[model samples]
Target: MRNNEMHEAGQGVLEDGHGRRFYYLRLSVTDACNFRCDYCLPEGYRARAGEAAPLSVAEAATAMRAFARLGTRKVRLSGGEPSLRADLPDIIAAARNTPGIRRVAVTSNGYKLPKVIDEWRRSGLDQLNISIDSLDAAEFARITGHDCLPRIRTGIDRALELGVQTKVNAVLLSDGATERLQQFLDWLRDTPVTLRFIELMQTGDNRDYFASNHLRGDTIERQLIESGWQLLPRAIDAGPAREYAHPDYRGSIGLITPYSRDFCQSCNRLRVSAQGKLHLCLFADAGLDLREEIRRGDVAALAERIQTLVGGKAASHYLQQGQTGATRNLSVIGG
Candidate 1:
């Protein structure tokens, strides 16, 4: 099907046998990152390999335009650290101008966000999701292998000051990090930033670390509710996180259980890596290469390939069966 035909056919709505609509696209702008988080990348992992072939800004814009033409209305720019790309604002602008696209967001580690929050807003960014695994100074350094918490906090404050919808993402590891959940929550009580707790997924080169850090969402929620905070439903879309709000709080809480429980039946997003591969599922070991094909000016073939991949997507991820190790690390693929 041609891109416009696919858009009119509503084939890109990506409804499964269960009638769930997949309309979101997560696009990774770069694979390079500055931080070496233990859970995301193994300790002492080589930061540089042979120079990797990343998609050019124009190529990324082409894929985004094609996705938009096929009914994708939401696109989130992600990366090993998306902010590292100097042309990030341009990418956001291109996606914003794409047909059928309604929202443009970015997920960053927040190390360099304080300086660019204003530019991001001016460039048509609708939202920002910052990854902050720990609030404590020393513990955060241990988790991210960097002393960037202060800068990250400043970036969050800047986002709030600029009136951007912001969310703080934290991953629950088996290192007893959940014990400090209340501390993080209390610190954010006065801010408008929502807190999201993510279960450590079994991916990348950190199998041993993930195996030790896997914490269930139910346990974390029960612990928080018992600590005198009320949890209320706050999910506005059909994404993985189950969001909740508390009485007398300025923000809310989001819990994502991709490993403990699979939400794949309602999975509505497609991931495009920095190398221009289309990943149907975050845990899938393989993906369809669209960069080369799209550059050849074959829009019809590209749309058909995407439809076939989505149709063949697995009902759920394999993490529940103790499976780990994807073809690429989370940084390269974009979570």
Candidate 2:
């Protein structure tokens, strides 16, 4: 399963049996999150078995170091809320400075950014994706079950004002969030941040939640067009989202349609859960346990194991085939 072709090109970039070279690593640092987004966390999620302990900041860096050396270029930090980790800046710095990792980014709820922005800036963090599903206070509170949208909104504004290359991530819950989505579109018209709407995905625990809240990317675009917005000439090449822009607006909009738009053909990423389980597909439970190998200092074996697992990445996830269950939820797997 070793990718001799990638090695022949230079450094050991991971390539699967399907021939996909993964340059981006979605590294989840913790399975804990501050908010209880209805679609992300199940109603009784925490009542189940406790999560495996997460990697320490240093341990996370070590994992990053290994992946970097194995030719992973970009690493994004995620968590229940990555900002909740105390050593986040250090973790970001470590990933940034890792020899082969070219950039480090973070996915957060943004409520904690006010406290970590300075350290994050100094650490050379490249991108920040704030999970903001709504700009309306009541709607936001209803979705996340937290009355912290004020803080999160302030956090997004601060990140943008501070010159952080920030992006806004919102989930499309078709039934009850149309007004909220429109409000966000109107509000973003004057802001400098790019907004990306992710189509709600279904998982085992949140199946009902997903059903009640799901929205399609195409529906959103139709609304935008009806409201006098134009689709951009081309979508941004990064990630799954098809991009769009407004003629009068400075920023753009992105659509992450994992269900309807199945981006499997262009998939080029891997994920490591906080407790050291390597996930090949976000919606697949199959994973490689790297906790012991990584903790015991066996870099060569760990890399080899990763190569073998990558070789088995399925043609596409079960979710793409209408199956919506996974061993891990989006929060645990780092979204």
Question: Relative to the unseen true structure, what is the C-alpha lDDT of residue 93 in candidate 1, on a scale of 0 to 100?
Answer: 91
Measured against the true structure, the TM-scores of the candidates, in listed sequence, are 0.90, 0.89
Model 1 lDDT tens row, 1-335: 46764453323555545555667889988877888888776453355667446777677777776676567778899988998898899998987776677788899989898888889998889889998888888988987888989988898888888888898888887676655676777786888877889887777576777767788877887876776667565332435777777777788888888855546665778898888888877888676778777676565567666766677777777778865436456786777
Tens digit of lDDT per residue, candidate 2, span 239-313?
A: 667777778777788888787645787787889988898988887765678988788766567777788778888
User: Number of backbone collisions per candidate, in order?
Assistant: 2, 3
Candidate 2 segments exceeding 4 Å error: 1-10, 42-51, 225-237
lDDT of predicted model 2: 0.76
Provide the lowest-lDDT 10-residue window in model 2: 1-10
lDDT of each: 0.76, 0.76
